[model samples]
Target: MKIWGEIMGKADDVMDICLLAGQIMLTYGAETYRVEETLERMAKSASFSNIHCFATTTGIFLSFEEKKEKEDLMQMVRVDDRLQDLGKVTDVNQVSRQFVAGDITIEEAHEKLTAIAKAPMQYPLWLIHIAAGIAGGGFSYLFGGGWFDLIPAFIAAVVSSIVVVEFERHLKVRFAAEFTAAFAGGTTAILLVLIGIGSNLDQIIIGSLMPLVPGVPLTNAVRDLMSGDLLAGVSRGAEALLTSLSIASGIALTISVFL
Candidate 1:
């Protein structure tokens, strides 16, 4: 009876680890197919059979049977508040592969996964802001803006990025944050051009807005569609579309008021 108990306990542990792994991946914007594949691989490595996994934009479901006891275990995890943090997804994938390859035990894998979930952002906030500015400046030049437009674009983008981050932190609503950021970017571009700091208002505003685009979500939506996960694809595509509309509405409002 004690040995049987130990086996059951081990099975439960394996299930918990698998759920945690799937949760981390999904919460950090991993594709549904990748999350399901990782769950299956982890469960199989634990000597489970009849494994099944289903993942969506907001949840994950997994079931497997323990070979030792011939019993089934199932788990469902609700994932909310997704963000584009491919670094975390990559870390979880590395841990999953190591566990499957026997380089790490289930407990070790769980520990690593937990650590990753708790890890801070890879780049500091100030550094990210600076990078956003550089991207805006570069995009402005690429889009035919002269050197005089670069500094204004850079400043506008940096301010927009900061406003988005601050608003999102407080409001927890991305749509509102994005809208405010767009408005702020437009206003900044206009002010800079009026002050003789920028040569082209259009280029400055366009470059500033680039930082707020939902590029990752749109790309992931397309990838999911191509992979035949129709439900997830549609859900993500809709989300991307809504975000794009938010950006466009914000910019339009700004243009109407200022220009």
Candidate 2:
């Protein structure tokens, strides 16, 4: 009885992990035809061989092609326990698209991805604070203000953004460290302009926080979709836009308050 229950539990876990792999594949912009392949590869990496029970790479594609039947294709046992160890994939649009494309069910894939994403990672507080401050100082310096003023402004921006990041972390209680760290990049940019240290506004703003700008992700995201890598494109683009806007908002608010 104990062994039977254990197997059933393991089976459920495998299914969850397998679906998560599909979600990540989609988020990373893998093609519908390729998502299953990615999922299989990731599963194997986690040391589970039971995932073969799920459909084959070819079979998954065929199922998607056969969407009219509404048949569930998640029943291959060849994957065995291989499906029990998938991690999160941070590409939302790709995941959505692939699920809609019938490569995987939205509910299963999305749920597993969300679950895995909640796992923790290192959160760098001081570095993020310094980055934001540096962003501010760089912006002010570019504008032609004296180093004295620029230094203060830089310090202010860094300090304020750090507080904001910390407060946000406290309230949200998610990846506080990471959230603040990434957010600090934008805040630093905002702080520079508010302090009014530089000459060419455009150049100063642009130069100050270029490091924080998610340019590659934004450009690639759009380009990927336009170039037919829809899954990957959407994922990166959304992330870029959000990050850009965040930086702008952070700085704008500080400047407005100072002015």
Candidate 3:
């Protein structure tokens, strides 16, 4: 009787661990398709047969097998965090997963990540001006415009980068989009606003904004790649590059009437 009870108890603990791990991974940003895979691996390691995982944008649930056959498989869940750290770590998503894996508490991650996230992130206006001038002037020179047009090109780089920053601030403070959409939309909106102001966006594209926008993602991807998050780093880099192109394209479309 004693032996049977001990076996049942160990089984229960395994189930508990699997269910908790699943819930935590979902919250950690695990995709729905991968949730079941994770749960299966966890359950097998935990030594169970009844393995399943369910999830939505809003929730995650899991079931595990044990010695208690036909018993109701348990489920565990938790609420979202009101506060979270969004810092630039060498491996961005790994921190989130580590936080979920019981390796480190959320509070600890938040503290460390907060510090990194708030770190100084800006390029001085003078450099921006020079970069923009070079880019715009070079493009103009390539396309048969006079050297004087480089002035507007320089101004364009400065303006575009500034607009991205300003737009990013509005999204963070007002609308609350995170790094991805905020970065993309912010750059886009800034260009739009410039066009609305009658500034030549074509010159801006030739300007230094490309360097400004690419810096963050490039940094983030480097961080991820260094952290051994190859997939994530590549994805972020691709996203950054694509977003930069999108902004340039948007500007081109808006001003194409002159061509």
Would you list the C-alpha lDDT of every candidate in the order shown?
Answer: 0.89, 0.47, 0.49
Give the local distance difference test score of model 3.
0.49
For residues 126-157, could you state the per-residue lDDT of candidate 2 as single tens digits?
87667766776676666665555455545555
Clashes of each: 0, 19, 4
Error of 2 at 170 (Å): 5.6
Candidate 1 Cα deviation (angstroms), residue 159: 1.1
How well does each candidate superpose onto the true structure, as a TM-score? 0.96, 0.43, 0.37
Per-residue accuracy of model 3 over 19-123 as CA lDDT, tens digit each: 444444444344334445555665565456666765442355677656455444666565242111122323334544554465764345555445444444344
Predictions ranked by lDDT, top down?
1, 3, 2
State in Å the error of residue 117, model 1: 0.6
For this target, which candidate reaches the highest TM-score against the unseen true structure? 1
Clashing pairs in 1: none
Tens-place lDDT per residue, model 1, 104-213, is: 98779889988998999999999988999999998998898999999999999998899999999999999999999989988898889988998988889888988898
Cα-based RMSD of the predictions, in order? 1.2, 11.3, 10.2
